[model samples]
Target: MFLGTGGMTPGHQLAERDDRKTAWAWYRGRAVRDLANGYTMKRVYR
Candidate 1:
């Protein structure tokens, strides 16, 4: 089962014209795993 680990919030500030993103973790040469809601996941195979 996945755990609910509280973390930073993923947000974009319109007033400050900020477009930012964050991820929990990443893996290479493999499928990306799903994280808790609002969490981003990425994988790169080199």
Candidate 2:
């Protein structure tokens, strides 16, 4: 049902140019099982 529990956003600012590109690509992946409704879902981004 896509409970939209929790998720991560990968972003950066131009001021933070010192940051590495890999850092922006790293984000938390999430998924859950909902057998009662017979569906699998993942968190949604705002």
Give lDDT for model 1: 0.29
Candidate 2 segments exceeding 4 Å error: 1-19, 28-46
Estimate the TM-score for candidate 2.
0.18
Best by TM-score: 2
The clash number for model 1 is 0
What is the number of backbone collisions in each predicted candidate, taken in the order shown?
A: 0, 0
Q: What are the C-alpha RMSDs, in order, of all predicted structures?
A: 15.8, 17.8
**Structure candidate 1, residue pairs in collision:** none
Report model 1's TM-score to 2 decimal places. Answer: 0.12
lDDT of 1 at 11: 25
